[model samples]
Every structure is written in C-alpha cells, then in structure tokens.
Target: AQRVTQPEKLLSVFKGAPVELKCNYSYSGSPELFWYVQYSRQRLQLLLRHISRESIKGFTADLNKGETSFHLKKPFAQEEDSAMYYCALGGRNTGFQKLVFGTGTRLLVSP
Candidate 1:
C-alpha cells in the first residue's frame, strides 16, 4: 500500500520568510515523488520532481528515500505564492499519469 501525508493543513508566513511543507509517505515499492502547486486562480502545476532535482518558482523538494519523505521548501516566500500544494506519489502497475495526492497544504503568504 502507498500513502502520503501532509502534516500541516495550513502554513501561514510573511513575505521573504522561509517556508517548509512537510510530507511523509509509505510505500512498499519504489515510488516517483512530485510536488504540485495551485496558485490563486491558476491550475495545479508541477512544482518539482524528485527525479529532476530542479526547483520551480523559488521552491525545491528533495526525496529522502530512507525517511520516506519529500518536503517542499523555499528560502523566500512571496505573497503571490499563496496557494494550495499537494504532495503526490506515482508509479505502480498503474499508468504514469495516475497519482496519489495528499490532502494538501494551504500556504498563506502574507505581506
């Protein structure tokens, strides 16, 4: 069985402050990890992928295979960055597009 958990239901912070979104998962087999972000009115988009090791919109995430975690982080949070984020896991006998998503963490970036 595969499962993902985002500890915080909401994370509120000021602009320029550092932010961290906690995520933990449990899976028997190898799983592909991803962070998906949805800005104000924008559609949910991929923030980063553990496999790519790339950062998007000032945010980055690293997969800790040993800990079974993939936490999203950013050095400076921006007010415009306020949105909903979901930690997801993919890869099973299922298709690539099929993903299991966390409840989500609401990032409230205040000025």
Candidate 2:
C-alpha cells in the first residue's frame, strides 16, 4: 500500500517570509512524488515533480527517499501564493499509474 501524509492543515505566513509545507509518504516500490496547488476558485494544477527537479512559481520540492519525505519549500511567500497545496505519490499499480494524494495543506499569506 502507498500513502501520503501532510501533517499541517493550515500554514500562515507573511509576505516575503519563507514557507515550507511538509509531506511524508510510505510505499513499497519506487515512488514518484509531486506537489499540486489549487488557487481560490480555480482548478488544481501541478506545481512540481520530483523527477523534473524544477521549480515553479518559486516553489520547489525534493524527494528524500531515505527520509520518506517530499517537503515543499519557497524562499519567500507572496500574497498570490496563498492556496491549497497537496502532496501526491505516484507509482505503478498492476501496470497502471496510481496516484495517492495527501489531505493537503492550506497556505494563507498575509500582507
């Protein structure tokens, strides 16, 4: 079985402050981790993937297999960055791609 856990339900930060959203996972086989964000009244979109090793909108997440974690981080928080962030795990299940998502962490950026 595979699972993703996001301990914090809400994270509040002020503009220009650093932000970190923690995520942990458990899986038997190799896992693919991803970060997804959903803005207010908008559809969910992929923020970054561990395999890509790229940063989007100033957010980045690195897969730490030894620690079984994939934490999202940003140098600075912006008011427009406020949104719902979800950590997802992807792997092959019976020859098909299976994705397991965490409950998610809501980010609130204040001015």
Candidate 3:
C-alpha cells in the first residue's frame, strides 16, 4: 500500500518564527516527492521536490528514505507565505496522473 500523511490540520505562528510541516509516506518502490502550496485566492503550485533538491520561497524539503518522510521547513515564517501546504507522493503505481496529496496543513502566519 502507498499513502501520504500530514499530521496537522493547522499550524499557527507569529511572523518570523521557524516553521516545520511534517509529512510521512509509505510506498513500495522509488517514489517522487513534492510539496505543494496554495495561497489565499490562488492556485496550488509546486513548492519543491525531492528529486530537484530545490528551495522555493525560502522553504526547503529533504527526503528521508530511512524514515519514509519528506518534511517541509523554513527558518522564518512570513505573512505572505501563509497558506495551505500539502505533502505529495508520486509513483507510477498510484494510477493518478500526477501526485497524491496528503489532507493538507493550513499555515496561519500572524503578526
């Protein structure tokens, strides 16, 4: 079985604080991992990917094969960055054309 799990429904914090969004996945084979973010009144877009090893909008994610996790992290939370975050897993066997997403975690950045 293959699945992605995001443990939090919401994460609230003050501006300039560190942020971490936990994600865990279970898959049988090599899996492509990604982080997608949706801003207020905007479309969902790819934040980062495990394969690319890139960082977007000051956020970075590292894939840990040993723990089956790919956690998103940022040194400081910004008000503009506040939005809905989702961890995703992509594998050929899932039958989905793209990636399969976790439920999502709402990040609330307040001043």
Candidate 4:
C-alpha cells in the first residue's frame, strides 16, 4: 500500500534557526509530491510542488525520486513560520490520481 510518513509530530525551534521537515513516501509509479501548510488562523494551502521548483515564504522542497522522499526545508525560521505542515502524495490508485496525506508535523518557532 502507498503511504506518506512524517515521523515528527512536534518540532520546536528558535527564531532564525534552520528548519527541516522530513517526509518520506512509498508508491509504485511516479508521484506528484507537495507541501501543504496551515498557519495559526489560516486555511490549509499549498506551499510548493515538486514540478514548480519554486519557493513560497522562504521554504523549498525537492522531490527525490530515487529515495522517494520530498523533504521541506527553510534556511531561517520565523515566528510566523510556525504552523502545521503536511506532506501529500499524488498517485494513481485505480483509475485516477488520489492524494495521500501524511500525519502532519507541527512546527513551533520560539522567540
């Protein structure tokens, strides 16, 4: 079965610290990986996608097909960067592609 794994449930870091949210996935075929984030009072939204190779809010993620991993990274953390991040995998199950979300990682940035 295809699965998305986020081992860390809670991560704490100080302001201006480098942060990395680990994510690993398992699937049979090519997958479209994405990083979704939800701020304190905001709705869940896309942070970035593998194909875009773009960075949103100083965060970047590269999909490693060989390792089946798409890890989110941020050079410097900020208080507002604190949020719940989710790693999602878009893969074909039967007839269409479906999104499989990880458990989620709650990042807390301390001042």
The count of residue-pair clashes in candidate 1 stands at 0
Report the candidate with higher TM-score, 1 versus 4. 4
Better of 3 and 4 by TM-score: 3
lDDT of 1 by residue, 88-110 (tens): 99987336568989999999999
Instruction: Give lDDT tens digits, candidate 3, residues 2-29.
Output: 7999999999999999999999999888
Q: List the residue pairs that clash in candidate 4.
A: none
Residue range 1-111, candidate 2, lDDT tens digits:
688999999999999999999999998788889999999999999999999999899998889999999999999999999999999999884137767899999999999
- Per-model TM-score, in order, reads 0.93, 0.96, 0.95, 0.94
- Going through the candidates in order, what is the number of backbone clashes in each? 0, 0, 0, 0
Q: Give candidate 3 regions above 4 Å deviation.
A: none
Best by lDDT: 2
* Candidate 2 lowest-lDDT run of ten: 91-100
Candidate 3 has what TM-score? Answer: 0.95
RMSD of each: 1.4, 1.2, 1.1, 1.2
Error of 3 at 26 (Å): 0.6
Q: Scored by Cα lDDT, where does model 4 land? A: 0.92
lDDT of each: 0.91, 0.93, 0.92, 0.92
Model 2 has an lDDT value of 0.93
